[model samples]
Target: MSMSTSSMSAMSSAPSAFMTPASATSVLISGAGPTGLTLACLLARQGVAVRVIERAPQPHTGSRGKTLNARSLEVLADLGLAGDLLAEGRTGLPFRRYFDGAFAAESDPSADTPPTPGAPYPASLHLPQDRIEELLRARLAELGVAVEFGTELTGFEQDGERVTARLADGREVTAQYLVACDGGRSTVRKQLGVAFTGTGEPEPAMVVGDLELTGLEPTAWHQWFGPQGALMLCPFGEEGDRWQVQATPETGPDGTALAPSLEGFRRIIARHTGRDDIRVHAAGWLSSWRVNVRMAEQYRVGRVLLAGDAAHVHPTAGGLGMNTGIQDAWNLGWKLGYALSGRARSALLDSYSEERRPIAAWTLETSAAGMAAVREGARTPGVGLEAVRVADITGLSLGYRGSSLAEDLLGGPLRAGDRAPDARCTDAEGRPIRLLETFAGDRFTLLAFGHRPALDPAALDLSAHLRTVTVDTDDPAGLRDTDGHARRAYGIEGDALVLVRPDNHVALTAPRGGEKAVLDYLARL
Candidate 1:
């Protein structure tokens, strides 16, 4: 059940104006990875015309990235797909580090509180990237949007108003916006002559094939850091049977590819696990990838924009690559929807690069730092600092600073440019709910404090259409208890007002007396 065929056909048809053939296409997204599929799904949900192209004939089934942070879960919840994903995926506890086959220190995700008020899925979820993409594809199909697979985006011609993409099959697709989710070796980024500058480390790691283990206990993930190197054995399935074993290679120079032979893989496993009799299943997919921390010089050039590995590619040390790409889609999805719908200014699209590029750079830098610490064998004071640093690779610590969204505050609490945290609260019926539950729908939320006072809703309209929610606070601390991270991140104090965008960023904040301040801010959006 794709989007109505007639509507899609109408969207594909050329416009009557002479601006450009590409501008006639609403939004054309390249690559059907999680980023492209997510952007497609969100835009389609908002009734925006969108199409996704992929070079692969089908979705990737291998277990690439298996960790999903709390912030990513919030984004999934916003799309109403978190429940389904959570049902199918396993939520592992924080990763535990090991040294010399002994327990080192454990990194607890629950330790850090969420930064936004009323955020759902505050805990990191452990799900394979393939599963997440599957869920996203299913969601996209339900919206009547099928990905055009086996189709390659050969080249593109971009003018001031639109982008004309030349497909490998000699077909021309014109789109108002061209998004490149085309992985690390992005043709789009190269065509734009965007330099991906970074250094590749000489650490050779081997991801073992899909193996069903027998002897090792399936209680938790096991990481062995010995004289040889680091070997991490993590559970990939529910019954704790199937596992993904990663070990540093014994013989391989820089740029030399490791042979994916079963003998070679078993030798490393025997060296680390101290078991030569362990049976090996048919190797699913085994290869070595260099660890490089790189980001595109710019995320956008004219009508072309970049996301996922195209914008930035970093070491898998922190499992941040996929999560960052997903977040990139979430940030760009709404902006594209608004702009294409003719409800937002073109300048609003600029914020996408402004806000996300810095975050990507930070992710690249942090991942490199964590890899350096691992190489240097930097151990924390108590447990191993390597594990703590490895845990940070998830990119959950990212936050936004210096943006129009985050500005002056009169100091009641809850400031702009903060990642909204979630808390447990009750509606008028006294039913318990999370703060993110209020923002389940596809609209902006204006969280108002105090009693049912006389206020004009239209004054707070940041867009032509917006959603507002007024929650009277009886216990400020109680609200914080529900979502302390959001309160502190936003600087929400007693009797203060807060405006949260659809994507959960604090758009406006005001003191108790400045209701007009909030009103005027919304009018500007």
Candidate 2:
């Protein structure tokens, strides 16, 4: 019916020295970007004490990392913040391109694909990275945790028991675990001596910045390609005048490109577009970008772990950078919570690296291929933005099928480690509810199917960490799959049970009487 009140209370009120002035916190997360903020919100929702620190004085102003893929949006929706993002973000915005200052073509990459009942968000959302962080901060604040800005993790040391970190503000914090989401040049990763192996582009590829510009409509993403290079101005931020400027650098006679500056940006814009009417009034957050593909060999060292860009950094071609990092946090949050709660062994955290490291490797490959496609398109006439491949960028097809956590006792269309699909169902009162709504909270979900009988949640010995829902075709008292959407999505025809993880991946599948297999799967974690 509901979370076992006694079990939840016992776990939440578990005695922790973390509340003491000496111990400080349960988890100490460095870098208040999406990765750290998402992990903090998840852990806080489970009543775990978390401390987040950012070296910057305030929130980042630039509209950096603007794309949120469908998978990341689903995770945000589970956290109850997707509504705010969808309300503010623009979706299905067509690409308006020009060649040599003349109109070329307009195309929408996500035009063919539409949202399905199982996958509601099929298109990506275009929103500034800063706004995403602001929403996450608000959610974190509601959970009674505030990100400490200007507080830097200068260094840290960890043993088998705990982590002791020293901040630039001369304060030392002690926590059960430490996580680094501090971007590509992570000090923690460097201190851990993890090898970041990959090649880098020697030359500056592009200059990106946020600016206030006129002569540009805020309706579509505008691109200008000419002899000098390519320039793209996409409307973003909360105001009508704001836009993100990305342009190729102008090479001098000496074979060196000019560095990114406001004057340089204006000159490049004028030369590329062959128009001086597009005024650049003010510029902010300018930086020269180069293609660097690198990944950490391992994600965890002792009690300190790496996440986000700290673990991997790849080309910014398919907008996978931010989404990959956000998903990384989602995978780790629950494992960390289980470990800290003492309900699971500390070894459970090792799966975090085993499962996610391969995904990052795959992302590096996908993004590199996407970058190559963009380059090939640039050389071909009339290719325009259509050259950027739009397949699998949504991240919906990704799964941990090879993971050790995946248990395959019963074979079916959806196997262990597959993403659990959502379906429309109803309660005994005939009220409609989505499958994702039932899986939203940070807990394992057990879906028991068949008309014969159901495994009781209280008998599972995981009532504190699990929720059980019975799906029966004939029983009016259970969840009514009137349209058979749940059964069709899961490919179920008879009595079966599905166990889902906190990250919404199927842990295992079994027959009606196979309760031991379910407990064994969770015990391995």
On TM-score, the candidate that comes out on top is 2
Give the number of the best model, judged by lDDT. 2
Per residue, candidate 2 scores C-alpha lDDT tens digits across 104-200 of 8888887776677777885689998988999999999999999999988777666578877777655678999999999999977877777888989
TM-score list, all predictions: 0.85, 0.92
lDDT of each: 0.69, 0.84
lDDT of 1: 0.69
- TM-score of candidate 1 versus the correct structure, residues matched by position: 0.85
Residue 275 lDDT (model 1): 67
What residue runs in model 1 are displaced by over 4 Å at the alpha carbon?
1-24, 94-122, 201-209, 252-257, 378-397, 453-464, 473-493, 513-516
Model 2, residue 514: C-alpha shift (Å): 2.5
The digit string of per-residue lDDT tens for model 1 on 451-521 reads 33245765644455565455555533233234344444445545566667767777766666666766666
